[model samples]
Target: MNQPSTPASWRMWLASGQPRTLGIIAQTISTVISLMCALLFLAIAFGWYMDPLLALHLFLGAILCLAFIHRTGNPLGTKNMTFAGALLALLSIACCGYLVFEQGRLSERLPVLDPLTDLDLVVSVVLLILVLEATRRCIGMTLVVLVSVFLMYGIWGDQIDGPFYHRALSLEEMADHLVFTTEGLFGPALDVAALLVFVFVIFGALFDRFGGGNFFHDIAQSLVGNQHGAPAKVSVISSALYGSVSGSPTADVVTTGSFTIPLMVRDGFSKVRASAIEAAASTGGSLLPPVMGSAAFLMSDFTGIAYSEIIIAAVFPAVFYFFCVYMSVNNHAMRHNLGASNKNQLPRFWHVLRKDWAYLVPLITIIWAVLALNRPAFAAALACLGMLPVFLTKSQYRQGFFKNLIKGLAKGVERVILVGVACAAAGLVVGTLSMTDLTGKISSAMFALASGSYVLTIITAVAVIVILGMGMPVPAVYALSAVLAAPALIALGTDVLSAHLFIVYFCALSAITPPVAVAAFAAASISGSNPMVIAVTACRIGLIAFIIPLIFLIRPELLLQGSPTDIIATITSTLIGCWALSGVTEGYLLGHLSKASRWLLAILTALIFIANSWISLAIGLCTLIFIYARRHQAQR
Candidate 1:
C-alpha cells in the first residue's frame, strides 16, 4: 500500500526530481530573497531614501532570482531550481549588482553625451537579455514578443518605408538610452512597480492571510447565501471585496472561484455559467477602488494623476459593473428556479462580524490613508503593520504568527514578480516609443484613419487597446495601450483621466474576452467547463463593463466629473440603462423577457447610454418604468 502523503513528500514531488539538498538550499535562498525584497520595499515606504534607480535595480534583481527558482507556469509550486536557472539567477544578480554599484556614476552621466564603457555595454546587453528571459518565464511570450518587436523597431525602423518608419538608434545609443538612463528599464513603469505596487501587494497578501479573505466571504454569504442563486451572488460580493485588495482578476478567480464555483455547480448553476459569473466578477475587482490592480498605480504614474482621484473616479463605474453582474445572476437564478441556500448552511452575519471584524480595520485603514492622507504607499505599509494585531486575535494564527508572516511575505514577493517583470519589459516599449516618436505616428495614423471623427477615433482606439490586451497582463496591456491608443483619444479632446481609464477597462475586460481570456480559462479548470464557453458567457454577464467605458467617455458625469445634479441624473439614467442591458443579456427582468421585449430593452439601453439631455433620460426612464409595470400586470 502507498504511504499517506505529507507536506514534505509533496515538496519533494514538486521539486521535480532535484536532489534533496539542492531543493532545500533553493527553498532557503528563495525565502531569504523574499524577505529581503519585502523589507527593502517596506523601508522605502517608511521614508528610507535611496536612489530610485538603485532601488529598482535591486527589486528587479530579486524578482528575477525568485522567478528562476520558483519555476515558470506554476505559481504555488515549490522551488525547483535547475543548473540553467541557477546560472541565469547568478547572472541576473551580477548584472543588477553592477548597476546598483555604479548608480552614482551613471546618475551623473548624460544619455547620448557620455559614452558607455565596454563593460557598461556588456552589462546593458546581458541585463536586457535577462529581463526578456525573466519576462518570458514569469509573464509568458506575449509581452516578450511585444517588447522584442519594439526593440527591433528601435534598431531598424529607419530602414522601413511606411507611415510607421522612424529614425533608428545605433547599438551604442540603444544601450545607453535603455540601460544607462532612467528613460528605459528604470522608467516610470518599473519605478511604480518597485515602489507603490509592491507594498500594496504585500498589504493585500497579508490581509488575506490574516483573515480578510474569510471575512469577505462570510459577509457576502451572510448577505446573500440564503437567497436565490446564493452561490453566484456570494461569488460576486466576495470577489469584489477581495479583488479590490488583490488587484488581480486571475488570482481572485483562483482564490474565490475555488470555493464559489464548486458551490455554484452544486447549487444547479451550469458549469459554464458559474465559471463565467466568477470570471466576470473577479475581472471587475481590478477596476474597484482603494488598492486596485497594479495597472491602476501605473495609470497614476503615467498620467501624473493622484491615486486617490483615480480610485474616486473609478467608484461609480466599478459599482455599476458589479451591479450588472448581480442583476444577471439574479435573473438567471430566478429564470431557472435555482434553489435558495439553507440559512443554516451559511455563516451568521453577527457571528462573522464578532469573530472577524478586526480583519476589516486594515482595509479601512488603507482606504483612509489613500483617500484622506493621499499617501498610497504609506497607507499600504500602515495596513501591513496593522495586520499584525489581527493575526494575534486568532489562537491558531498566533501560534504560527512568524511562520505565517514569512509565508505572506514570500507569497507577496512571488506575486510581485509578474508585475515587476511586466513593468520592466514595458519600460523597453515606452523607451522605444519615446526615442522613436512611435506614439505620435500611431496617434496621427489613427486620426487620419478615422477621418477626424472623434467617435470613430475612439472606436478605432478601443479596438487597438483590446487587440493589444489579448494574451497580455493588465499592466502590460495598459502600458502599451496608454502609449499606443491613449494619445489618440487625448488628441481627440478626451479628458486625460477618461482616456487612460478607458484603456484600463478594456485591458481588464480582455481577461474575460474570448479566445485569450486568462481569467475565464482560470475558471474553466475549477468549473470543468469549456474555456471558450466560459469566456462567451462572461462577456454576456459583463456586458455592462464594455459599455460603461463608452458611456463615461461620452458623458463624464458617470465618472463623477460633472455637477452634483448632473452626476445624479447621469447615474440614475445609467442605472436604468444597465438594468435594461442586464435584462436583455439574461432574458429576464421582472420576468422572462420575450425576443421583442429584449430588442426593446436593447434599444433603450443604447438611448440611455447616449443620452445627452434630460429629455433623453426622461424618455428612457418612462419607457423602462412602463415595461416593468406592464410585465408586473401581465404576471398578475
Candidate 2:
C-alpha cells in the first residue's frame, strides 16, 4: 500500500524554512498578490463599490483568521488537530474568498439559505466554529466559552424567560447576520484593528529598534538614579516610559524589571517588594497616553470618540498613577535609607537629554500630528517611521541600520498576529451582542439592579467587569467591557468617554490582580518572588489606579469634560486623595506615621471624595500642615 500522504499545511509550514531562495521568491510573490488585492479594494471602495468593498473586507478578515491560527499553532492539540484546524480555516477562507471573487454576483442571495447556495449558511456555521476554536487556541477556553454562551443566547434567547431574553434569531438568519453584516465578525471592532492598530504597532516596533526603550531608561535613570530609593524610583520611571509604548505589561516587566529588579535588590529592597513595584508600574503602561495599548484605539471606535480626546482625557490619570508609584518608591527608600549618592554621582540630566533628545522628535511629531494637525492615526504613525532613517545618521546605529530596520518591521508584523487575533475574537463578541440585542438588555438590567442610582450602577458595572477581567488579556477585557459594563454606565448618564475609559482603567489593573496576574507572574520569574504575593503587593502599590476610576467617574472634568477650573479642582482633590491613601496604605509619608496619623490620613482620603469643595480643601490643608509639622518635629 502507498504511504499515507502528509497534509499540505505541514509541507508548506515545514518547507517555508528550506530551499531558501525559492522560499524568498514565493514570499515575494505572495506579498505582491496581497498588495494587488489591497489596491483593488482601495480603488473600488473609493468609487462607491459598497458591496465589493465589504466583501473584500470580510474576505481579508477570513485570511487574517487563518494566518493567526497558523502562527499561534494548534496549541490545544497535536499536528492532527492542527491539520483539522487548518482545514477549517481554509474552508472559512474559501467562503470569504468566494465573495471577494464574485462580489456583486450573489447580491440578493448572500448569506441567506436558498436551494441554490445553502453553501453560505454552511460556510458561516463552520466559520463561527473556526473562530471559536481559534479563540480557544490563542486566548484560552475562557473567552471561547464566553463567546459560546453568547452564541447560545443569540440562538435560544426567546425561549428563555426574563428581561435578558430577546426574540431569538433563526439559525440561518443568525449565521447570515453574523457572517455577512458589518455588525458581526468584520464589524467596527475589527475595522479598528485592520485599519489603525497594526500600523501603530509596526511604527512602534521600528521606533523601538533604534533603541527607544533603552533611551527612555537611560533618561529616566540619569534623572533619578541617585535619588533616595533610586532603584525603586528607576523602576517606576523607566517602566512607565517603556510601557507607554510597549503596551504589554508582562513584556514590559520582563524587559525593564530584569534590570530594575536586580538593581533594587542590591540596593536593599526585599526581592518580593522589588518585583511587586516593577509589576505595578508596568501594569499601568496601558493607561499611559500616545498608545495606551489597543484599548485606546478600540475606544475610539466603540465610543465614537476622537483619538486626541481619548489621549487627553487619560493624561491626568496616567500622570497621577505614575506619581503615586513614585511616592511609594520614595517612601520605601526613605524607610530603608537606600540611596546616598548625590547629583554629582548621577548622570547630568542635561547631558542625558543632549544625547537622547533626537529620539524625542518622532514622539513629539506623532503627538503633534494627532492633536495639532488632526491627521489620521495610521498616517501619523507612518510618518513617525521617517525618523528611523534619520537615527542612522549617528555613527553607532549606522553599521546595522538596514538590518535593524528589517528586523523591526518583521517583528512588528509578528506582534500584529497577537493583537489582530484578540481584535478578531473581540469582534465575535461584538457580533454576538449585536445580533442578540443582548448588549442593550444587559445595560437595562444593570440600571434596574442598581435601583437607578447613578453611583450604584457605575459601581456595579466596574465590579462585574473586574471579575470578568480576571485571567484575560487587557485587550480581551477592554473589548468585552465595551459591550457589557460600559453601556450600563453610559445608560446611567455617565460621560460617554469617561465611562468607556473607566472600564479600561479597571480592566488594565487586572494584570496585577491576584490568582492569575500576567505582569506579576512575569516579575516573579525575574525576582523569584511568589507570584501571588507579588500580585497582592502590586495591588497595594497600584492603589492610585484603583482610586482614579472612581474619581473620574464622579468628576468627568478630570476626563477633560468640563471647564478648566473644574478640571483643576477635581484634579487637585484627586491628587491629595492619592497622596493620603498611598501614605496610609504603604505605611510611610513625611516620616513613619503614628496610628493617629494613619487614621487622620484615611479620614482625609474619604473627605476628598465625599465632602464639599471647601471642606475637602480644608482637610487637604490640614493634612499638608500635619505632614510638615511631623517632619519638623522629627528634625528637632
Candidate 3:
C-alpha cells in the first residue's frame, strides 16, 4: 500500500512548494517576533527595559536557526548560508534589542563630524534590507516590490518627473533611512509589530491549538445549525468567535472554511455562495474586538489611546457588521427555500459541548485577564502560556503534549521573524521621513490638496490609505495608514479613538478591496470561483466595512466614546441602520422583497437608519411608511 503523502508531496505535485514550510514557519515566527517586540515596548511604556544584549541574543538565535535549518534546499552552500544568515540575523536583532534595552542610546549611532562614523546606522541599514529580502521570500513579491518603489522614489527624487517628487538620496542618506531611522524599517509598523500586535498574533495561534477556535465552531453549530440557512449562521457565529482571536481574514477563512465551506456545499448552497459567505464573514474578524485583526495594536500605538478604549469603541461597529452578515444570509436562505438539514443529522450540541467544554477556558481566561488587568499584551502572553494545562489532562493527547508544547513555542518564535525583520525594513520609510522632516512635507502636500474642506480631506485621506494599503499586509497597512491618516482625521476634528479606528478599519478591510483583494482571492482559490466574483461578493457581504468607518466619523458615540446615554443612542441607531441596510441589500426584512422594493428599501433604510439626525430620521420613517403603503396596495 502507498503511504500517505505530506504537505511536501502536495507542493511537489503543484510545483509550488519551494517555500511552503518555510513560508508558513516564517509567518508563524513573524507573529511571535511581533509579540516580543510589543513586550519590549510595554517595558518602555512602563519603564522596565530588557537587556539589549539578551534580547539581541534571543532574536539572533531564532533567526539563524530558521534561516539555516529551513533554507537547506536553496541555492546557497550550507556553510556560506549559515554564516550569512547568522550575521544578518544578529544585526537585525541588535537593532531591536537596542531600541528595547537602550531606548535613548540610539543617538550615539547618529552621524557626528562624519555622518559615515555611525556604526549602528550602517549595520542596521544593511541588516534591515536583508530582513526585507527574507520577508519577500516568505510572503510574496508585492510588499518588497512596493517598498522598493518607495526607496527608489526617495533616492531619485530630483530625477523624477512628477510634481510630488523630491530630491534623491545619496547612498549614505539612504542608509540613514533604510537602517538607522525609525521611518524605513523601525517605523510605526515595526513598532506596533514589535510592541503591540505580536501578542495578539500569538494569542490567535495558541487559541487555535488549544481548541479555542474549535470551541467557537462547536458553539456556533449548536446555536444555529438547526436554523434556516444554518450553514451561513454557523459562518456568522463561528467567524465572530474566531475573528476575536485570529485577527486575519485569510487566517479565519482557512480555519473556519476547512469545515464551514464543505458543510455549506453539502447543505444545498452553491460553491460560490458558500465561499462568498465564509469570505465575507471571516473578513469581519479583523473588525471584531479584543484581538481585532491586530489593528487595535497599531491604533493604540499611533493615536496614543489605550487599547481598552479602542476595544470598547470598536464593539458597536463590529456588532453591526456581524448583524448585517447574519441578516444577509437569512434573507437569501428564505428567498431560496434553504432550510436546516434533518434534525438527526446535526451535531449533538450537548455532546460537542461536553467533549470540547474545556476549550472555552483559555478564551474566557484571556478576556477576563485583559479586562481585569487592562494590559492587552501581557494578557495575551499569559493566556498563550495558560492554554497548555488544559491540553495536558487528556490521556489521548497527553503523550505528545510536551512535544507539541515545544513545537508551539518554536512556532511562536518563527511566526514573528518576518514581521520583526519586515518592520525593521519598513522602518526605513518612517525613519527617513522623521529624520528628514519628509512626513511633514507630505502632510503639507495632503493638506494643500484639501485646501480647506475637512470632508474632502477625509475622503482624500481614506483614498490614500486604501491605495497604500493595497500593497501591504493588514498589520503593515494599519501601521502605515495610522501614521499618515490619523493626523488628517484629527485635523478634521475626529476624536483620537474614532480617527484611528477609521483608518484601521479601512486598512484591514483593504484585504478584500478590489485589484489586490488578497483575502478574497485566497478564498476564491479554495472555492474555485472567479476571483473578481469572490471579491465583489465579499465586498457586498461586508458592506458594513464601507459604512462603519463613515458612521464612526459621523458619530464618535458609535465607537463608544460618548456618555452612557450617547453610547446607547449611537448603538441603537447603528443597529437600526444595520438592519435597514441588510433589508435593503438582502431584499428581505419580514418576507421576500421584490427587486424594486429591495432597491427602495435599501435606499430608505440607509437614509433613515444611518442618518441619525431627527430630520433624516423623519424622512426615512415617511419613506418606510410609503413603502409599506405601496406593498399593501399591490397585494390588494
Point to the candidate with the largest lDDT: 1
- What would the TM-score be for candidate 3 when compared with the true structure? 0.83
Please count the clashing residue pairs in each candidate, in the order shown.
Answer: 0, 0, 44
lDDT by residue for model 1 (16-99), tens: 221122367888898899999999899999889987878988998898777776654333433355677889889999899998
lDDT (0 to 1) per candidate:
0.86, 0.72, 0.67
Residue 627, candidate 2: alpha-carbon lDDT: 79
Candidate ranking (TM-score, best to worst): 1, 2, 3
By lDDT, is 2 or 3 better? 2
- Candidate 2's error at 440, in angstroms? 2.1
Best by TM-score: 1
C-alpha lDDT (0 to 100) for residue 371 of candidate 2: 87
Model 1 lDDT-worst window of ten: 13-22
- Per-residue lDDT of model 2, residues 1-636, tens digit only: 966656855543322111111245334433443344333333332342445346435535544543533443433223322454446556656766765665565555545454235776677777677666556555566676777788888887889887777875788787767767777776766666655665566666767778888877778878888779887888899889888877778778988999999988988899999999999999889899877867888888777778888998899999999998889888878877887446666677788777677787777777777788554453445445556644655666778776676566555654555566666677777888877788888888888889999878877887778777766767778888878888777766778888889888888998898776879989999988899999999999998888788777777777867787766777777788778787888788988988988898888788786664446667777777877888899889
Candidate 2 TM-score over all chains jointly: 0.86
Judged by whole-model lDDT over C-alpha atoms, candidate 3 comes out at 0.67
